[model samples]
Target: MAHVVSAMASETSPEDLTDLSLEQLLNLEVISASRLGQKSSQAPTSVSILTANDIRTFGWRTLAEALNSMRGLFTSNDRNYSYLGIRGFMRGGDYNSRILLMIDGQRMNENIYDGGYIAQEFMLDMDLVERIEYIPGSGSSIYGANAFLGMINVVTKQGKAIDGSQLAGEIGTFDTYKGRVSYGKTLKNGTDLLFSASHYDTAGVENLYFPGYDSPETNNGIAHKMDDERADRLFGKIKFEELTLSGGYVDRGRHVPTAAFDGIFNDPLFFTDDKQFFSNLKYEKALNENTSLLLKGFYQGYDYYGDQAYIVNDARVINHDEASGRWWGGEAQLTTHPFEGHRLIAGLEYQYDQRQRLLNYDLDPYLPYLESHRNGHRVEVYLQDDIQLLDDLVFSAGARLDYHHMLKNLQLNPRVGLIWSPLTNTQFKLLYSSTFRAPNAWERDYNAFGFVDNPLMREEQIKSYEAIAEWRSDSNLRLLGTLFYNDISQLLEGHLTGDADGNYALINAGRFHAYGGELEAEKRWSNGRLLKASYTYSLLTNENRHGAWANASPQNLFKLHYAEPLFDNYLSLGLESIFIDSRKNGLGGKVNGYELVNINLSSDKLIHGLDTSFGIYNVFDSHYQMLGVSENIDVLRMNGREFRLKFQLTF
Candidate 1:
């Protein structure tokens, strides 16, 4: 499968791009890199793209699975939630707050936690995605906040892409099952509409063993039927001419088996439920060949509920936790060519957080521990210009000024990039950028029995520098290499204070530094053959602390992906392999690293109006462990081999 669509045109729709030639796909335009439609090679930062074709061929079940195949990116799951790791910067307990996630240019991060959901909790089903654009490095100059490391943009398929009604069903190992129904079409009056709904359920691992709870009373370190998960999602979109409306909703529930947060082991009462919803309205128009205008508004809401069973005074007690968040925002952007050699982009953005609520208490006794409600707003303005300094050189510069209500302060972020293309097929870039992440409400105002609030916490800041080189051949072969350095300050870390209560608080810790390098190569053949490989090396450390900051970040990562047509175009096969170096866990113990291989066989032409696929994940059944997020849990064992069979019918 071809991972990147080089045939994408600047203003063309996804359905139109499919009809273009391979050469056009090689120059595919990316929007997440600079909020503008520009070729990936010409973008201000390093970018990677994946299309729906790749997802179908690889049998990717979730967004995280698709993203994990990219260079310098990985994900870990504790059987409850998934976390994203980028270039050795993933920290234990962090809720993926540093990376920004957008769906069709609408921010999806909630107001309270600022977390990007990538697992089953994600709003859109994988089948609904048209393409995903990943831009690495500091992106605050264009995006206000939560773009500390990188950003992701998910583009949904248009109604015309589906062109009809569809039904899909899947059955996987461990009693997992899923079903989806969708309808889409383009009306004769130029109106486009699409709607989809899906439901998923999994019994999960039957006998999950936790070494920390080995007593007989705790099921001898084994948890039975405690890792179950269920999710439901709905998405809809409509478009007419230049105006578009879209919305999505997801509700997910997962059972915990690790006894996290001091929960009772082998108890079925430990579970978390998450729900998110968003609606977006957008308008776009081209004033002329050299000018374009865009305006958008969005509303988002999030809710979380959790129950943890604990032993209080030798009796079983249940603790209830809940949070609710709601927010609305708007943006106006203009892109124009001020002169022959310059392209300028300017935008204004505003957001109002209407509600931020957190509640925690004990059941049965009706004892309250914490209750808080707060609201805030933010405003930002940014400008970026790309100038053709010379025939073979391009200079890009941008900056943003933001006013945050919580901080009561103004922040300025800047970015610069210089690209030199000495040869038509070769280019080199030097880039520098700075970004920040504001402390969320959960980290600032949630004071509870086991946690304390820090209202005066400072925002985390980072500066990144990168040098990149890329080369592409006419035969659809590409090679890329990059070296990067990141310096971070005032990082927020949850630590136990010296107080007698043993309460944990979020504090602005000392500085951290990371340096890394990445190398990648990809080649594609016209006969449905592709090969891609990437390697990453990183060294991360804390300047103020002596111990290793190896939360979940690995030092070395290697990935490979291959796809080929089989049986004279009747079937397609995909193979993927990944290797991660060993890393130290949160408890100062080393977690052994392991490799994983996955295979998938798929075909869309085997039957009329039907698509079939079979996938085997973790083919080797490597017993790996990922760092745990809770203080009571040191490491969480990962899943073994699993199989899935799926079929889709279109009418």
Candidate 2:
């Protein structure tokens, strides 16, 4: 667990948070919960923070792996993309539009599909990440859209933290290799500069077996030498005084071994490429003792291209699918103390989507199947107030209104929270909020060979209620609990229309309800020893049919993490365990439950300025499967075991 530090007025200069005692750290202050620095107990929602130390100790390879260790979240992969499951509600093959992702306070979701890429396709390398802030619950009242279930903000390290140049390299199982070079320095003129670049490639598994495709022509159920992937990333940042500029870019390509979407099996031509780029500029200034002003502008773009090999009239043809998007946005915010007990925050935002295009074609005959192009914009205004009614109690209320030209609709969302401190070390909170997600261009206008367009699709909505409690003891132990329920309506889902060719269409499902509870316990020692555990239970049902929802996540999840310093503080060991219950596969069949064990060993001071780590994932070699996208492959097998060794030197 990351130690909480004292609150500061400026958001960028948080170097103080790195140096704090255990007792002070227990009282954590989170920024994403309220868009400002505040104690966890006083914030409107429950917050979880993971620091760069955690990443190094646990040897987490990706953002998905780090987030899965949290209390009430899980992630699944379809071999093409990774999808996040929140509160036991997950739709297979989803693009992760329900969760909002940010990097240094800038949105990462693109304009066309609104997809939040979390795996290797993500723009930033894990080495540059300073910390991750997770605020679980609806945040549309502040962020406008795509904040239905959770808001994750990834904070990057400052130039002062690095202070030099660094080079790193890693080798992993399946012929995987990675290399990185970074430079950061703060000059005597009070200016800071940072830059980093990374490259990764992997041959993937030598062979993968799919029982559903167990035919002689499909290489006897085995796909060989077709799961290769490669990626490259570049990032940079500059800061001086009240102004900051930062940008990042990533390009990745992955081969599809499962032959999803009725592609030809054992074909190496089936693959997809994704490229994403974004740049942001921000300014912060203090107008007076009681008022502050902030401004930001950002531009982001995305491009996706895919090739699927299929047999048509006993001949192989490649289907080329392409999509591209470009968007730019600006925001202005003001924070002031209006009264003796009231703090007010107000902001306005506008976004212009310059390009949203999708197209599909064949290379041989050069036949164009589908072509769509469009542009749109959005405007939003939000305000929030936190009032201290008593010495130990606070009330918070906020709302936002958004107008979208594409949807031709206006939406308003609200949030309210009440917090009370009954004892010196105990606190309680009650929260209520509502959020919505508009259908993206992919769902509303994508008409392809195996899909139909639905231009009249509407937005989905959710209402959530939660109660939370926190208690801390003098023995360096902390416990937290939360109970919550959510009502969801008009969920967009792909439905089989019973056509002879098995064409699918996107439609809004009627209604759904989910209830869950989470419990977490953490203990820390003064000698660098730590123990943490958490359990989550959720039940999700379809209100329209009075039955369980299809492809929903497991009802129970348990996770544990432990770390200990060894060899006179020269080395450390980290261990973790994860258990996931069985889940339905949407085909009236169930995927069995499984558990995993991961271990890591690392040391930063053993060789002075040199850091090294060794990690083994899935030590027990557990066998498991996850729900797939198409009917041909209803379930996809998971990886069994892997190994990685990394070294970094700073000069």
Q: Please report the candidate that would top TM-score against the real structure.
A: 1
lDDT per residue for candidate 1 within 150-197, as digits (tens), equals 887788888888899999999999999999999999999999999999
Cα RMSD for predicted model 2: 2.8
**Top model number, lDDT:** 1
Report, for every candidate in turn, its global Cα lDDT versus the true structure. 0.83, 0.82
Question: Following a full C-alpha superposition, what root-mean-square deviation does model 1 have from the true structure?
Answer: 2.7
Write one digit per residue (lDDT tens) for candidate 2, span 1-651.
011122343443454344333355545566522443266556777777777777888898888888888888888888878888888988666578888888887889888778888899888999888777787764333566887787777788887778899999999999999999999999999899999999999999889888888889889889998888999999999999988899999999999999887899989899999999999888887899988777888888999999999999999999999999999989888878888998888888888989999998999978899899988888888888888889888888888888876566799988888889888788888888987888888788888878898777777889989898988888878899999898989998778979898998888875888899999998877766779899999988888777665355789999999989899878989898988888888777877877878999999888889999999999988767777666767778888899999999999
Q: What TM-score does structure 2 among the candidates reach?
A: 0.96
Locate the minimum summed-lDDT window of 10 residues in model 2: 1-10
lDDT of 2 at 176: 96
Candidate 1 regions with alpha-carbon error over 4 angstroms: 1-7, 10-13, 16-23, 32-37, 139-141, 546-549, 629-632
CA lDDT, candidate 2, residue 651: 92
